[model samples]
Target: MKLKVIGIIAILLVVVGASCQSDDQIEFKRYYSGGSLVYQQHCQNCHGDKGQGLSALIPPLTDSIYLKNNKRKLACFIKNGLKGKITVAGRSFDDQMQPDDIAPLEIAKVLTYVTNSFGNNMGTVTLQQVQDDLNNCQ
Candidate 1:
């Protein structure tokens, strides 16, 4: 009887594990696809498809220190465009970053991609966060 109970528990665990990939994960998959398209069109030319920087001109987003340390700054800087001096991952970037062209929703999607891809582990940037920052800027 104990052996049977153990077998049942094992089956239950397997069932639970199989169902762990839920609808939310599907949504994330979609978001990642959309963000990939956007990045390919806009960012890949300079940042490379894998988020690696173009030497001293463009900075790599694959570094976790830059993403995790300046997550909010990255979002805001992308939205508003950066000018003058800025530092990330013990390096300084002084170029002007063009403001994001897409809407708040699209911007959030792309940012989510950057935050989750390469070597980054940051969370998604919400549409509300983009909209609010844009409003505050103007």
Candidate 2:
């Protein structure tokens, strides 16, 4: 009876763990797809569909050096556009990030899209996270 109970418990744990894992995957997928649509609507033209950027006006998110270093700065900059010249991966972008005119949810969606895209592998940026950060913006 003891062995049977232990085996059943182990199986239950495995099943529970797998279910939780799948839920996370589904969440990520939702964020990814939503992000893609938001990007297409707000960003793709200047940044390129692949995030390769265009000339000196926009910076590519695919550049690992820039993405890693500027993740937080990028989020804040998205909230409030940066002016003058800003360099990424030794290249400069002189244009401003259009004020993320969308609702907080849309802004969060697009940020998640950029973070997950362009070969950058950051976790999803939740709407709550964006909301919290935006509350502190200047």
| Candidate of highest lDDT | 2
Model 2 segments more than 4 A misplaced = 1-20
Error of 1 at 54 (Å): 1.3
Q: What is the Cα-based lDDT of residue 36 in candidate 1?
A: 83
Report the lDDT tens digits of candidate 1 across residue range 1-138: 999999999999999997788876766777777888888887888889888887777888877876776655665676677788766656888887887657777777788898889878666677777677666663
Instruction: For candidate 2, write residues 1-138 as lDDT tens digits.
Output: 999999999999999887776666777778889989988987898889899888777888788777667655555677677787877768977877776656788777787778888888888778788888777776
Off by over 4 Å in 1: 1-20
lDDT accuracy of residue 2 in candidate 2: 100
Position 82, candidate 2: lDDT? 70
Work out how many backbone clashes candidate 2 has.
Answer: 0
Q: How does each model score on lDDT?
A: 0.76, 0.78
Model 1 poorest 10 in a row by lDDT: 69-78
Q: If candidate 2 were superposed on the true structure by all CA atoms, what would the RMSD be?
A: 5.2
Whole-model lDDT, model 2: 0.78
| Top-TM-score candidate index | 2
